[model samples]
Target chain A: MDYCRSGFKPKRSLEIILFTSEEPTRFGISCLGSRLLAGSEALAEALKATVDGQNISFLEAARSAGYARDEDDLSRVFLKNDSYSAFVELHIEQAPILEEEGISIGVVTNIAAPASIKVDFEGNGGHAGGVLMPDRNDAGLAAAELMLAIEKHATESGSLDTVGTVGILELYPGAINSIPSKAHLEIDVRDIEESFRNAVINKIHKAAKSIAKKRKVTLSEFKIINQDPPAHSNGSVIKAVVDASDELNLTYKYMISRAYHDSLFMARIAPMGMIFIPCYKGYSHKPEEYASPQDLENGVKVLALTLAKLSLR
Target chain B: MDYCRSGFKPKRSLEIILFTSEEPTRFGISCLGSRLLAGSEALAEALKATVDGQNISFLEAARSAGYARDEDDLSRVFLKNDSYSAFVELHIEQAPILEEEGISIGVVTNIAAPASIKVDFEGNGGHAGGVLMPDRNDAGLAAAELMLAIEKHATESGSLDTVGTVGILELYPGAINSIPSKAHLEIDVRDIEESFRNAVINKIHKAAKSIAKKRKVTLSEFKIINQDPPAHSNGSVIKAVVDASDELNLTYKYMISRAYHDSLFMARIAPMGMIFIPCYKGYSHKPEEYASPQDLENGVKVLALTLAKLSLR
Candidate 1:
């Protein structure tokens, strides 16, 4: 922003695009910014070659949902001569690997996309006092069992870079004295290895089915809230970040990003790279999450040099 | 009420009392109406002899809380010579025994009072994604084990009329992505026999301690919210109801009411009896709870006969 204010012009006709895709599309993708890149001809073709209607493409859904294309939006028109050659994003490393190793800069190798699932369990409701064990079918108890089972399966799977989380566990008509008749759980499973995630999720499915049968409760089909594969950074773009990191005298690592960012979808259209700064104790998504001033300055210098190098080429 | 309106009065000067003790006192004992009866000379002495300062008598609390007395209220003054002889109450049976058996009436022999316990478990919190087993203390998992253990202990207690219930089981900061740091459970245990209740509660205490130790979580002291000994109906009053049922030709059973009512505390003062008519499927505390017209009429006729006999005595 300071360079743009100072009118430091690049060698080429650069627009210095600042995109904000804040809207959430129906497929549960993070933002509408992904939809912008999905609208580009190259990404549309790439996605077509991979996930087949896993759900409708985000941009198609957005368009159908009345997000009309504006002539001013660059993503709606990828001019043959004006295609972007490279992309880069800088973020705080959400995991402890870089921080524990005391690295100043991390060149993210890939982003872990999540497959979110929601399970609804239904059981009989009655006065908690009067319902005896033999006669009572408690949905909350079933949900508790499932939550524990998820933790167990995830732990025992021993798959590297694989993580499962239950973001929401709620009981309906949540009065203390009434037996819960319904329970809803939101589970997010993410891994760099697709096969490993599928294996853990399969185990969870089997466990839930057996528990539901034993407890005589109705377990609803696990709904796929969001499903996206891991996205890898372009090798050449990663080289650019590495080169810049070395130029700036900062140690760098090629680490798998455990957190997802807009760049994951942006990679659909353009070759993309990611730079990460270490946060204290590998904590992110918390108020206490912090990065050292020196590490942040190192990231900014690397980002500037990398952007300039990409633009000049 | 019809007999008094028609001026077909009995030989004695009847007060035809309708008293209300609607305020909840500190001890959480139900039916402050019993407090009015406790204020009566007989019940106060009886309670003082048994339950040691069941929180300094409800009447004392009510008086201090500014419940001004109405001199005209008969309950405010039970003159020495005007000591009551008997008390009887009619209510819907809040259990399935009579409704399931097609019985017309239940001659309740006693009421069950509960000793409710609350336990809080505190554990370390961190990111579910990054926290691995053997290094993580999840309070939510500990809570799940405790809930299941409670069910197990209660099922195995094997004491007749003993019941254990967990009305509230909660995880603190219950977000899906973050590991839960705390758990709270509210347990209610009841039995007609005080020893049986203590036995079940002791088992729960042991189970919670073992679980907290195993999970390495800090457990809060168990709190007793409501503790009252079961109240037994008077033999003479029970005999009166039995005789009335025999005269009215309604089949009756000597039942122990599982749901407490004002009559539970009232039993401490005058010899008291209760009569119950079956509601649909024995469902009380619900909008769909209903008693057949024929069953209600039968209950009313028997209640009138029993009151006449008690008043005559």
Candidate 2:
């Protein structure tokens, strides 16, 4: 719609694509649409995924949504190697860096990748009062110790880019008077440098083992969900964005995107770049997440100019 | 049935009473029957209590169970001051102390009281990858810190009788890639001494405040569900239990009952005593929890002798 409103005719054909499941909200796999187009091996794993409480497989849901063509021949969804000249995405900067710096435009140089893991601890559950302190093997405390350790390792990784979160925690037979016999946690760690992120993850694993041993609990499971390498922006696409921002006289800064986007997978098939606009307090994935009209307009203008330059090239 | 089979009869009249809601499995109130009989002020609160998911009031359930005669005149259910001569309960030892020591009988001298509290933490939620380590105000981590602190304070309270457990933990918007915006925890602290248990609770409150302030999260709520004082066994009843065990030549030890029972509430209205036989591995409130037939028989014999003596007195 913005391109149509601009009324700028391009010499080369341009395509706009909106990807789905980039947030991993539905099937627990982000970049579902783009990953499939890029021919990710995760498709097999995702096909077996089931919706919680609904008892429906991802394959069934996809078929119901009219996505799957041939159940056995999924290659039909993959894009050809030479399908596009360049790919660029305009999105809200999901961090406070751009907004705090008063930058109108953010030229993303790198897209940080994430590594997620689910850890489950098993301990003896007894009456909370009946079990003496020395006799207790508390799974909840073990998970708590590991959670603090994850934060410590990420913060002490000697890089500000490193971040970790323990977002999901569950205890079995959750009652006020019963000791927890099982604790499960889902952890997310990210960095632009894969090595650094993995290093932090290694520390987490070691801490989990040590905590379990010390607490006399069992680290029953430590499963890694995904670990993808960071994607670097193409020089040509970066130059086009820089040139567009310079021509428009908009204040812009080169930044790394900590939030994942479809462009991360798109980089596998084509040269990919991203443009970011400042949102309110840099809040994303929340009800209060918002971007000003002026910021959106500036982003659209820069994106339009960059697309035109890429087409001419 | 055991007494009838033994062909043993008591010269004084005897009554067998079974209490309901001793586990707090319903309506979050333990010893509901005994508490009501002992004329606890908690009856007012219990009357307003509602079941989870079903949305039925405790009063309604009691009426449906044919227990409540008049909703407004609940005092009719209360036992008179001089209702019974003595109260004695026989149960499985919910801890490993007796089983580990190979003791056949446990003469409970005191029933440890529990103090339960529910805490809720509020923090900023965002994309796990987008939120930097330094910028995060994670409610889950805050709760974790407080949980560990509670354990530390209770363990260091200079009393082996002190114990604490964080049984229920819940995070809002619990997703693999989303930072937890809110965390709710239910903590149970117990001790044979009321002063010591209350001390640990006070330390927990202080630690909770400090953790919330340090993490820049809000300690939205700290609600105490119950705080009951420890109940001591009457000297006359304790002597009766000891004399009975001695007459049977059974190996016995005087111990504190860390788990609450109807005997605790009964102590408020009548002289009360409890006898415990070992359960497998001290496992209570679990499917694997078990007591041998021999242990059950021994417990019954001791209880029978103790009741016979109390009746004669």
Candidate 3:
């Protein structure tokens, strides 16, 4: 709106869309809006998705929020192949690489794909003192072993892009004096290369099985939540961004986004790219996350120039 | 009541007292009834103890439960030094020892004392996918390392009686895709030998510090909840139990009670001993926990005989 008010006009038509439910906070699915627009299978999931601890589905919530579209008219949300020349997203780097190198703009070539697994372990719990160490099958210990194994497998994967985290851990009948009878964990693994990410996941599964058997704990459940393929930026979009950065005399670096964005699913219907501005210390999804005003201005200038060049072409 | 109806009578006056809250389910303090009866410092703690998620203190709950006594009259609950000739408790062995050995009776020589500690770790949390492995200061990983360290220290403590358990684990902002920023754990360590138990606790504290420093996570809290000394059974009471078992031609073995009992605190005021009968598979504190009908009868016979003998003396 600021650029348009300044009398800057493009020959090609343009539409500014603000995607919704990109964080998965409501329906446990990221990029809901873009995925639906790109006619992806997530629409089916969204229709059936229910909010945690609630009786309402995502579609019902949308309806309550004034989205008055029937299932038959859902295609209206889909984008045609010729809907736009290209799609681009501007976001914080969510990592420290750009800031540490003193770069003003980042041209993302790839968005890392993510896979999540939920693991549950069951063991015979008893009095903490009564159950001798040799006779005990502690589920908490098994979960701990698996957490470390995940770190080891991802770190030794021989790829800097591969990473894993045990984000949630739970123990049943949690008491200071009673042994843990059950343990549950949620693990996240990601990499730019799907193969590398899958390899790490495989190792984690094997490790979970081996640890359960060795510790005499039961591997009750090992469910995969999602395994998405990495999305690559279109060549033309990349070239336009690089050319625009060079023309604007702004420092820029080509990087892979370890975090996925709306552009990931948007790439399915149209060419897509992403522009990243440096966030303080690369922190994201936290209260202290920050991006300097100067960096944001630089990112906006490059994005504006890139859009103008693409519109002219 | 069943034993009294069996045509058996003791020469001395007998009072059958039932203790309460030995499991620490309500006030987070085990042997609440006996701990107060024996005049331990726990009475003071109990006055300040509040039920989890409730506003009522233990004393208030006691009053609600029809316990008519003010703080000034609290001594009415305490037992005098010469309250009785002896004290004895009969319980099912909460371990597989007696059942596996096919023994009906287990004469307890000691009760393993318990010490509980609460630990909290803090780290820099970010997006699970965005945070690089080298850059992650994950509190969950630090807690995992510490859990394994605790098991290692207790197992290697060179005492069969030494045991430790991490029964409670909690992660802050627990989510499947977020790096854990904080972790909290409650640890239980126990042994018949206080020194051995304390040694393991010391090693755990050291390991926690080292792991925190190595992982760049902060050890925000290391609190000791309780560190009570192990209680030894009385010689005369043990002799009476042993003699009763021998005269009844019952199979018996002298063993230590890994599970603490009300008798642990009762020993402070009077000579104390415990008689254990075999339970099927030694399962306790669960729905599957059981003791055979014949085993219960045998335990009752021994108790009756032991009581008669002690009263006569």
Candidate 4:
């Protein structure tokens, strides 16, 4: 994993390689992931120099110039029984990390899951003035109570470490003069453990049911959306990374991800690990989000050296 | 004063007189109270017949129609001296009574004051998931508490006759996942006594202030969109109607208004009294709200006869 930085700038000529080990490769179709050109190209060039009689072809480029699925498949060159049967995906640190830390590489393990759930409470809307509290059904109030209970549930379950969140809840006929007749809430729960995730889900349903009963309102639960739990970096891949870093005498630390990245999904399909480069302010997902070119270069060099070792094996 | 409803319907072209007699003229203006058409026509027709005159005209018609203002001219026809004078105003019941009970006329002594207020609470909005109970202010919950307090205030006002109603409440970004940062509510309160009305207002303000402090949020109060006090009917006019009903052998009862009508305002300008005919099923405001034609005729007849007595002066 020994590498050096040229400058904190983006070079247009950087070559990016996407490996699936299949001939006539299509990149995005299976376990979709993005491969930035500079890192991928650097790794591909490094591997080309390390392997004997390696054939490299430049396929139709992506709209934004990454090695995306359907563009190339590495299965053509490597197979289950082939000497070089392993898959390695190289990409730029879309997020800045090592650049600010003045480190050249970052090793990642796991990513948090993304999810959204909807809870609906139906109740009768009537005159607040005429309806006695004991007789009236209020959905908004039910939702409020349910939200507080949910916060308690998550806190009690110690799920805050995994960070379950409630993002949006809405009521109908939201008029100041009308008692809320119906309410809908969206809860966002995410975690690396399936059991912990399911517990949070169960807690939400229980809260919804009890709140509905207490408010004398009808409540229903539905899964609006969810994403798979991100795969972990393979043990062998982590060993290779640590060995390569040791061989290069590089200072390194193992890390887990709080955010999602293409590597999260790729880890499921192969022995995958990511190398992060420091970003000035850790900014991403915005126009102003940026990373230093020198960090990018150092990150690419680590990937290149790591791939060189894998190619040699 | 005796006016005839000939058969069941009175399409009679009656002569209306213009008069300057203090009693008749004062009665005419009082008659013009809140129910301009009913009171003015009643008095105008009666005066015409008394003077045996045709087409009586008042110079203040434009002013009454809101076309002009009779600011300082006090010597005009019915405008007389600038001293305050009062008259007895008689109103035909807009609400049902005799018609539903098989009676022709029902006298009312008072009108209930209707108060409608809009309470809007404003606060800062933030990420619902990021903000915890103690870290943030919640206007929606505060609004709910305020609503409950309003009910409690109305009940504790010590006037069993008092009534308070919250008809509408709305919250900004009223999503289940988001903490409500702002809330708006509409309150309607009414009572026969002014003291009770003031008390209810005071309680509402007090509750709002306390809730704001408790929630660590700011609150602002404004005049009720509609705030008019209850009006008392004229004792003399009530007696006259009762005596006339007895003499004419018309079925009648003494009652108070449960709903507001234009006559509520007229009662304030003059010694006022009302006669109610029944409405079928107590349905008054909806499109299906109706009173039988026979009930209408009987009400008109009683009203016509009552007018005849005061019109002759």
Candidate 5:
């Protein structure tokens, strides 16, 4: 509000669109922003993908979208075409890079995408007391090995940009007195570099196969839930932001974003870039999330200058 | 039914009670038969005890038990108790003991109870992408280690009589893209000797404590979900079964019953004994579950003699 109040305006006419939406997709879910402006092509692509083991269908979205069949409400919801010439997003770094390096601004190189992976481990379930150690094929044990294997493989894989997470582990017939027959694990792997992500994924698959064979359990292939390729920043926007930061004499770094943003979708239609200011200890989506006032002001000034230069284009 | 068709009734007119009920309590709720037979005193004790984390109140039981109440026509249910002088149950040996040893009959010594243990692991949840491998207190990873540790501890433990199973493993905020904030594990530890079960439990607790400390995650002590102490077969009943096995010249072993039976509760009412026959590959509760006719016949004959002797007493 203060920045808007200041009598600072870009060279060309500026339109500041304020949006009131729900929380960020906490990793691609039933969200608001992305789905609204992503356009039909992207929506169709997303609809073709699978989420939480369910196929996302255009018909389903169409059904839900038309939930308010009353004329007045449905008219309000419409998809508009590619409007903006160029887009720039200013956000908190959501990581320690800028603060750790004491940089006032971060010129985002690329935004990484999460690769959802599910590994199904199947073994024979039996009475805990009846199934002896030597004879039993415990699926839970196999799953445990897979979790550790993910940590090992992800860490050892070529790129530090790669990250693997085994978040949801569910045991079928999950009883206190029965040996786990089926273990279902949901893993999320991510990397800005597609090849690096693929490499980490390959290692994970190999480990799962080896562990399952060794433990006498069946391992399912990596089920890709939802995966989008990394979105690279526009060169023009990047150059403008760099020049702006230099003019203001504020330290800036080119950093790849481990997190996703709305600009990823916008990048399809128009050139998109993101300017990031530091947050306290990289704490984001937390109560203690903070950014130094001076650093934020410095980032704002850089962003203003970048907008001024981009408007001229 | 065939065993009853033999028309070899005990001298004191025998009233065989045939019962049909729902499957075993997967997590200790919505089951019948045993609790009804157990007198008010025993039922009171059971109600006070927590089974699979549900409070055993009469109100809750009545509500679930009356699921069939809305039916237009249904058979009325009744609970009759303390009705017999002696109760003897004949079952397949779910364990490999009799089949491995080639014993015709098993003179049951005692039925071991499952020590239902639940380990609650609380760790700080964060975005899997944002949290680094080193900074993360990943509960899922810790749980994986615990699962393997259980397998190691149980297998390496002294007696084969002791069995540990981590059946149900649940990860909190179980999204593919979120770091597991908490992991709740249901552990079932069974042993014929009370001391051995306690020892194994102690070892498990110690291991959890150690793991939690190393991983920087918080570990809570084992919360006993439900525990039914080892039920020793009646001394006179054991002697009678032993004598019956001897008279038939069938090799028998005094075996501990790892599986539960109605007689586990019947022991509180009368002199209770169990006869175990060998099943193929020690498979029970499975479609392939099969007991040899010869072994079952041998077991039936022993059971008949034991009943005859007890009836005479």
Candidate 6:
């Protein structure tokens, strides 16, 4: 109660704004909320009593008295107090787990970090007609041979459980008759296990080295980029979620996040867990992307009930 | 005098037109006599007399005649006579043989036939996230595996000399994230030997079938296009060329044609051989592509002497 009237109490409201850019004007709204709604009255009384003890007779528990509105801006307002804050985020699972099982809420354990790499191979360029087989350095051919090598290595290295994928391969100077002097390719590697991850990288490097030697082409490898390993939800939070789900007679299964979320940041500061409702067809970041209203309501209900228990504690 | 005035009187100069497209125009002219010019008088006289002949006039003797003008076209007109006619054809050589050797003329034994094949690989395209191993028939993956199979079959069919090349590979609805539903590729195979050629085709078919079965993808293979076997030069004409070279005491080498030429038609009518003058840097069919005057004279000298000996007989 005291925390609600404190300055630290989060004020939750929907804010709408319009942003103009070269592409188009976008209308967006941010819905914010405070967790101290129940404690506001108690916090106000405590402040009133403190003013009286200081011998200020004119002090009264006036709700408007505590509210300070900015004289210059109508949108700005403030309350003087202090309180702690917490946040929760909700999203849909990318994989086909909740929908396939007809489950309402999915408890997520961890999110995998996708590692993307861009490898640019540079070689000497000469006339295709003038260069001989024994003396030529053909980067496009090298890139092609490397692509096949990666495929071959991926196939031979392990079972289907851990597969290496070349999701994108774009070649520059891509003319039919021109031998590419420099071939740039972006290779993405993803694996849940560290060994397999290293294996993919090592095998690619091996193939590149051997091919460079065979083709007489010089190659420089650059890592270009990487995202850190994302953390998993706390075991206690996961258990609490499971318990809450059981009490509500809602069935849930633990799953990997398989995507990024704002809650991913929250997991670093405090115990964190995620609830996923099914996304229809798992289409996301597209116009066709949609989630069922019933599913969203079910997920919200799960979140509300879970938070209710956590709040009492 | 009788031969020059009646049956084979020297005719007016003629020009040949090659093309009327946006491409560069090719022109040709045959001089009946030389006035300290680049052409031979004997060769020119022979051409004019036959063109003016009543029975063997240019129009009557033409394999196919268009409008005649006093303009030169490299694509059509060459020195013509009742006994023999020269054809000047301007074309591009797709191969790099002459360029590799720093030679001008390409004496081709045969021209490779272009073949088109329909390779239909039917596989299931589903949510890449939903489908697990043993349930997916990825046509693009199968095609990629089969590509290596093709390279392997061509390499191991006991002849490293055979050249099988892939021209186009297209995946239906190409998407990086989707499992390919179908993959179609067009491959071109070339070889000097017919046996090796047949072996390559047979092995590719075998590899495709085996890979499809192994990968659980259904592949339907059909030869949509095939050309007739490449024809070789006449043995007698080749021998005469060798004899002529020996008589000239010129430094020369007997080389097979690495490209198709217009003389392919002439081989049907009479024993035909080609004397190649070295093209400077083996350039052709472009304004920048050039052949030295010395090389042109060498070829013309060989042709003139050969014709002189044949005309006497």
Candidate number of the best DockQ = 2
Report the error of model 3 at residue B295, Å. 2.6
DockQ of 2: 0.79
Against the true structure, candidate 5 reaches a TM-score of 0.77
What lDDT would each prediction earn against the true structure?
A: 0.70, 0.89, 0.88, 0.55, 0.74, 0.50
Residue by residue across B1-313, what tens digits does model 4's lDDT show? 3333333333423333232221113332322333333233444444333321333334344346563374523222232222112233333343334445767767877776767777877665443433333445667666767766776787778876566655456666654334566777767676778788778988898888888888787886544665667888777677778877788787788877645555565454445667776765443323435666866776666666655555554
A1-313: candidate 1 lDDT, tens digit per residue: 6667776666654444454433222333344355445464444444333322465654454456666444223444443322668778888786667788988899989877657788988876555544555776778778878878887887777775677766466775464455677788877677777777788888888888888999889997677666677889999889889999898788999988766777776777778789999878666445567889988888888888788777777
TM-score, prediction 4 = 0.49
Instruction: Give the per-residue lDDT of model 5 (tens digit) for B179-264.
Output: 78789888888778777777878888889989999989999656875566778888998899999999999999988888777766
Candidate 2 residue-wise lDDT at A67: 67
CAPRI-style docking class of model 5 based on DockQ: acceptable
Show pairs that collide, candidate 2. none
- Across A1-313, the per-residue lDDT of candidate 2 in tens digits comes to 6556778677789988988877776667778889889887668555664563477777678778886745845667789878988999999998888888999999999999778899999999898989998889999999999999999999999889999999899998788778899999999999999999999999999999999999999999999888888999999999999999999999999999998889898998999999999988767777879999999999999998999999987
**lDDT (Cα, tens digit) per residue for candidate 2, span B49-117:** 456457877777877878664765566778877898899999999999889999999999999987899
Considering lDDT, where higher is better, how would the candidates rank from best to worst?
Answer: 2, 3, 5, 1, 4, 6
For every model in order, the TM-score on chain A comes to 0.81, 0.95, 0.93, 0.59, 0.77, 0.60
Winning model by lDDT: 2
TM-score of each: 0.76, 0.95, 0.92, 0.49, 0.77, 0.58
Q: Which ten residues in a row have the lowest lDDT in candidate 6 chain B?
A: B27-36
lDDT of 1 by residue, B12-121 (tens): 44444454533223443345456455455444444333322454544454456665443223255433322657777888886667888988989988777667788898
Off by over 4 Å in 4: A1-313, B1-109, B173-178, B220-227, B236-259, B273-313
**lDDT by residue for model 6 over B224-284, one digit each (tens)?**
4443244465555455555665676655555544333444334433345666655534333
Question: Over all chains combined, what TM-score does candidate 1 have?
Answer: 0.76
- DockQ of model 3, rounded to 2 decimals: 0.69
| Model 4 chain A worst lDDT run, 10 consecutive residues | A22-31
Q: Give the candidates in order of TM-score, highest first.
A: 2, 3, 5, 1, 6, 4
- Cα lDDT, model 4, residue A274: 64
Each model's fnat?
A: 0.23, 0.81, 0.72, 0.12, 0.62, 0.03
